[model samples]
Target chain A: MEIKILGTGCPNCKTLENRVRRVVTQNNIDARIIKVEDIMDIMSYNIMATPGLVVNEKVMTKGRVPSEREIHELLTL
Target chain B: MFLNPTKNREKAGIRKYSALWTGILVAIILIVVFVRFDLFERLENGVNWFVFGLLNLPADSHLASALEFFLYDSIKILFLVFVIVFLMGIVNSYFPVDRVKNYLSRNKLYGFEYLMASLFGTVTPFCSCSSVPLFIGFVSGGIPLGVTFSFLITSPLVNEVAIGLFVGLFGLKTTLIYVISGVLLGTVSGIILQTLKLEKYLSPWVKDILSKAQHEQEVFQLEKQSFKERLPVIWQEAAKIIKGILPYVLIGIAIGGLMHGYIPQGFFEKYIGKDNPFAVPIAVILAVPMYSNASGILPVIQVLVSKGIPLGTAIAFMMGVVGLSFPEAMLLKKIMSWKLIAIFFGTVSLCIIISGYLFNFIL
Candidate 1:
């Protein structure tokens, strides 16, 4: 599984990134986590709001950081 | 070294000085008359038409009903904007900058703190202009630039006026979504800016201020006054801000009230209703350059929503108007270069448009 955290480099984006990392590690999932910090790259995803979560190339959540359990469910799906 | 000329020279110098002062006074009076009679009143009256005419519509006219819808739904929005600004002024005065700095600086790269600040900012309802001074204080006090941005972005976007308008017009569910979205955006944007190592992009002056945190000590050194002393200061600040804003408020209300009483029904429906694909973008573009307080724009938004305009599009438009007005951009020019201003506008505009689509898709 591949999870992408999209943001420029703000505190919330860092939080989301850390939370996702924790969730992935705890689940023992073989997932690749990537952070996109470039404005153009983030914008290319058509995400105006930052700290977005992209799971398997589809935007799953944005603007807010979802809970670890929520991420687990999203990954499972 | 010259001949004996003291007495006559003194009298002549005094007379020349008096003549010069009289000439300056006459010029000033003439200029005041010209401005008052020939320019100021005319401009004021002309601008008033834009504000009032939008509200007053002929009964049979196509726009009358649409205008009426807005007028009726904007009262809560007006109340919220006023309350938020007032409260923020109080809070700003109450909490000294040192305290905020100490709290933020205690932790290094704590994401949770940023989120909290963003949430607090959203609830406060300060406009971008009013928030700038606070932002300057925060960043200069050694708080992370990203954390400051979190507060700055959310303050205007999630203001009380927007919330009140949402609650009154769309009810609790929509209001909740709006609040949640605002917090998320603020937090995420803050974190992203942090990651990019963009703090270096800030002006050298800002860096200099932050480096010399010792200077801020003087700000806190003032004799700590009791709550009683503080209360008067708070009241004075509030009164000053209110006095400054009252005219805009009245102007906004007058237009909004008139719109409520007039406007034709279904007029806006045919043009930018929910089904229109271009409605979202068009609304975004139109709202970007416009300037108005929350109270001023609420009536217009209410009418659009009543005419079946999509909720997301209307929200995007409102955000554009309130969060990224032309006036704000112009004012920011004093603090930031034109390039930064353009980037700020572009980034926020894109954010709003995407948020609009996201809401439309989800809700």
Candidate 2:
């Protein structure tokens, strides 16, 4: 599994990354996580808002963080 | 495919929705009851008396009275912020204003187009920091220099938080002027800069990008998201805003409270008062370096207006901090050339100054 978090290091972005990390660790899932901070790099994903989440090359969410259960469910899949 | 997670807590989710509805119904009933029984007034009066008692100083103590006033004002303003921010969160959830690449990439736009773009910028929610990325996105996507400039200014300066706080703190008339003037400042500056043919001022990296057709295919997907898909996200965003801004609100209101209690009317009148026509211009200069978020600054603005400072002069100071902060300008340097940065600030500063003077004279 692969997850990419996109933002320019705002507070919300930081929180989202931390949450994703915690969820991944707790689940003990074999997943690769990447943080994308560059403006152009993130835009290439077609997200208009920060703190976007891309899972397996698919954009999952943008502008807001998903819930813990939501993350857990996504990982389980 | 990623979004449809089976409801693991279907029971819990149902209960939550029911609870939400019940809470709303209860709130409505409570409001009606409070209005009929004058419970709200009684509650407020009691709170005031309780604050006085808590201070435990003589009524004549200037500092004690000021503390009381600060407590009262802060509570009121905080409550207002909480309600407005929550509603705005829902609105934002429903009407997500995606920065349209197609519209922004236009080679040339009429004056009305610039006005519309600036106004759109005002209504969409964004902070100064987040706005930098949007600005970069617009510029990189071949958004006209002037139109992009307008979005850059309006995005940070005139958002829901600023406008809501203004209306709650300064009343409708002043807020109307501030909103209109803020958007107009963006529009006029955009037109002026475009006329000067300042596209050369943009960073070479941004200006050189002419990938019109290839980049067009990378459009934001999720336009067809169901309400269920977005509900949790909306709540999360609204909660983030309230939590993030609450601290600043308290701190701002505390300062405002102190200003109200301790500062004499004559003190303000003497310094940045109406007699000093330079007050507005001075405020514009002072506010840039002291830049903070609108949430942090609006309470202080409330203090200035309450302190007998002219509306226009105080507004100039507010615009200064909100519109063009030193930090934001520095950040813009990433994509904007030195000349472009200078032009952006120069035009905005001039417009802010003019607005300050206009408000002072008219009102």
Candidate 3:
């Protein structure tokens, strides 16, 4: 599985990235997590707010950080 | 499909809270009525009495007066901000950002689009740091650059928190003027920028994004939730906002209190007072580099007004600080060319200055 976190390195984006990292390690999910910091690429995802979570090229959430449990569910699924 | 699990339990929770929520709703209404009927005057008097009569501090002392100012303003302004944020939070849950974005992209409102955009700017709660993504989203979504500009301009300048602080500090009349002027400033600036046909000034990065296929439109499932189900989330959001801004509010009030007690009457009047023909422009210019949120700046503005600065100049400074900050410029720099940023800032600054002069002349 592939997960891309889209943001311009805002604090919220960092928080989301950290949460995603923790959820992945704790759940032992087999997924590659990538952070997209470039504004151009982030906009391609069509999210108006930062800290978007894209799993398998599909946007799971945008503009807010999801809980760890939510992230685990998103990845495991 | 999403993280919203335990649907049955959530529904049950909503049912259980309905009665308690009703009581909360009634209490809120009663408090609004109480605040409306000049109850703040009584509160102010109580503070004054506590400071002067109970504390036995001489009214003439600056320390006593400053303490009184700080305590009264902190309590009154915090309460006012909480009420405004809570009410706006409920409104926000109903009008989510995705819905607004979809609506803006899907419809053509003739000339009224700019007005609609400006109004959305006021209601949307995103901070200045989020402006870049929003700007990119709107432009790439095929919304006009001008309409996007309207949203970007007013989003920071006018908001519920700012309104609450304005009402707390400057009263309803000035707050109304500030809000009307802020919205108009955004609308007018957007219209003017749109006519300039400055699309080429956009960075190559954005132009590249514009050429790509637009992403699939997704409807937000969260928006379909009933108000009762959304109530707990709204309360949590409102509380979070209050907690976030509490420190700024206190520090601002503290600074304002010092000025209120220690600054001699007519001190600021000697320079930026109404008699100074250039005060408005100076205030606006001085405020551009210094960035602070509305909560931090409004208390200082209240003190400045008390120090004999004209209301228009003070308000102009407040708008400049909130709207045309260096940090916002730095963020926008990632997406826009220097020339574009200059034009955007220059136009907004000019509008603010003109409004300042108008405000001083009228008020």
- Native-vs-model 3 lDDT? 0.84
DockQ of each: 0.01, 0.36, 0.63
Q: Candidate 3 clashing pairs?
A: none
Writing each residue's lDDT as its tens digit, candidate 2 over B1-363 gives 554455644654565456446445654675577569975467567666776676567777777667776666666666555555555554555345563444545434555767877877775777555665676566556666777777777767787677768866887698899989989998988888778888676666656553342233354332444445655665576667767777888788788877888787756776677778678788899887776667877888788777787889888888888788777777678677888888779888999999999989899
What TM-score would you give candidate 3 relative to the actual structure?
0.87
lDDT of 1 by residue, B248-283 (tens): 555654564455456555667777766777777778
| Highest TM-score model number | 3
Instruction: Give the per-residue lDDT digits (tens) of candidate 3, residues A17-62.
Output: 9999999888888889999998778877878887899999999988
Docking tier of model 2: it is acceptable
- Considering the two chains of model 1, state its CAPRI-style docking category: incorrect
Give the winner by DockQ.
3
Any runs in candidate 3 off by more than 4 Å, and if so which? A22-32, A67-77, B1-32, B36-38, B211-222
A-chain TM-score, model 3: 0.95
Score every model by TM-score. Answer: 0.55, 0.83, 0.87
Model 2, residue B254: distance off in Å is: 1.5
| Native contacts recovered by model 3 | 0.72
Candidate 3 docks with a DockQ of: 0.63
Off by over 4 Å in 2: B1-43, B52-58, B99-110, B140-142, B211-232
